[model samples]
Target: MDQPRGVESAPVQQLLNLLVDRLDSAEQRGSAGVKSIALGERTWPALYMAHRESEKENLWEHIIELSCWGWLVVKPEVATRSRSGYADSPRVTVANILEVRKAVGRSTRIKSAVERWREAVREGLHGTDEVKAAVSEFCIDMPDRSMAEVVERLNVLPSLVGKELLLREVSSQLFWGMSKVLDKRQGLVAAVLGVDECPFPESPIQLQVFLPESGYHGVLFIENLMCFERAIRSKSSAFDGLALVYASGYKGGAQRLRTHDGCSLFYSTRGGFRQDLRASFEAWLFSKDVIPAFFWGDLDWSGMRILSVMRTTFLELAAWEPGYCQMLAALIGGNGHAPEAADKQGQKALDFSGCFYADTYLLPALHSYKKFVDQEQIRF
Candidate 1:
């Protein structure tokens, strides 16, 4: 909506901008010819959500003022009963979509960059999910970067620009945010560039060995460093004779262990870990007796997914019950944080972790409490 003289406030303007955008999108989808769009319709839930947010900011009255001034048409509030079936609540409906679109000066719908790119690469992009997502994001988000230019230079991906060129060229934000895209879908990049494999930069396998004098009995991968460090320092009998490896949040790339030189272990030579012990560690890691593999992380959805991901490689891998059980106890004891608080807002509530303890105990506890506990919270 136009900044009405002497009336436009920040919250009101933000609310109007959101409303106009929502209405404009509706118009783009054939709402231009239609007369009125209900604010409560399933298709327009965002409109209702925006209204509710404005209500919380005490900006709805200012919005009503704009409607009264003929800035936009908002149907008169209809009185409604609350969900409790007791209180009176009023529903604000948009009287017309065209009028709102006009207010924002959104004219004839034009194809977005993504749509144009999709049309151009019609059959070419059917290679892999990662390539498709990365290419679409490049076209839509990076207005200056040309996908055509990148495709033409795809042959020089690894040799000229280094292995991470495709990922680096696409978007730095996308690379780190969805780091496993290249790891999982490198085949598509290879196929496009006519190479056997995309030689992407790889991080050395990091491990914090805690093998006893008698030799390690099992391997445990800890997701977060805090918990990994805590587990080592705890001197708990439960972790005795277990080799602890800090997972470092590498999902699909963790499976690269089977590749030649993939198990190039990273260690601090200055510490107790001697340079000569590297070969023995690597050998034991690849040995058949590397059974009883366990993963321990936060009590969040992503943590469970990490366990599921590692399971693809370590088929025998299961959730580290002791660490997870402690987190579960803390969650049930009301000592956990909301998903938003931990920046885990995007983590989907996965029902299974391919491990009985996680699927039955951890997942249910997280779903029941709607909360997450960091593995570091449990010292023992």
Candidate 2:
């Protein structure tokens, strides 16, 4: 695309110069390409101020002209808007670097970093079928990120890291400053690197399960640690045939049971004995004859939310009447603390948890009292 006539104003020329400078810097750093570079305070503060000052005089006519010329890509497609609506600043990036360079009379071609990164990726494609598939579809598209650094990380995958390592450990070894580079594209990283069986770092939150010695009848998910410890210590007759599982604030990992790796939860943490116990627990959890499930947590909105979330995995999960009844009695007697007192001011008031026990008895009590009682308050 050629530069349009009558759009060669000073501001427009200055903006074009800035784009060329950014492109040259990107080339030096081996970036794939820039995208969505905000033409605001962050990227071009000086230009932004100039635009603001010139607003009353030129009224962004230069921006419109450059955008109309196809030399710059303005967000919101402002080409269709009337002049009155162009008051606010829109994000802008070079639509075509070659055209911008030509317009600025600096048409020197530089080899793209994306092509180099792609070649490197292809060269390192000697892994399994899964790796090959992921690599073939891998894209070098993150804006302002170095493709060379990514290539270096990809190259180190074969020798630097071991199988079944945590994602954080790999990230730390890669030393990509605060960014969990491996964590983002897990499938690609896992396949290309053979770091773990599952693409993601296994859940660090372990489910502290106590399988009943007697025949299994049901399961109770305990939310807090103290309550879980208490349940194990008590060994009450009420929990005789029920398997007790400590929820451990699990929200996402529990949902993975419905996926291809139902047993991956067991394989998450290291150790053979621990793995065996988790396997047994997983098997019993997903048995054909659905076991009755119940949840016992704090009489607060967060607990209710956890129950509602975990219910997706444990279909029959509901509020445990025995525990909630105790909590409810405490709340009604004004034995509970206010939301602010308990640092629960941020907790949202949940009106439901998809359980008769919760909907019928628990939610109403919490809403009515606006108080919370921890599960640990109730002994057994």
The candidate that wins on TM-score is: 1
Residue 240, model 1: Cα distance from true site in angstroms = 1.0
Candidate 1 runs further than 4 Å off: 1-109, 118-141, 155-188, 199-205, 208-210, 250-253, 268-280, 287-289
- The runs of at least 3 residues in candidate 2 whose Cα sits more than 4 Å from the true structure, single-residue gaps closed, are 1-151, 158-169, 176-205, 251-253, 257-282, 286-289
Taking every candidate in turn, the Cα RMSD to the unseen true structure, in Å, is: 10.6, 9.8
Query: Candidate 1's C-alpha lDDT?
Result: 0.59
Task: List the global CA lDDT of all models.
Answer: 0.59, 0.67
lDDT of candidate 2 over 234-302, digit per residue (tens): 856766666677656644226644443333342212122354554555665555347687888888998
- What TM-score does prediction 1 earn? 0.56
Error of 2 at 322 (Å): 0.4
Q: Give the TM-score of candidate 2.
A: 0.53
- Candidate 2 differs from the real structure by a C-alpha RMSD in angstroms, to one decimal, of 9.8
Q: Give the per-residue lDDT of model 1 (tens digit) for 92-208.
A: 444554554455555445656666665445445444555555545434223455645434434343344443443434324333334443544555455554457655545445555
Q: After best superposition, candidate 2 residue 291: deviation in angstroms?
A: 0.9
Candidate 2, residue 247: Cα displacement in angstroms equals 3.2
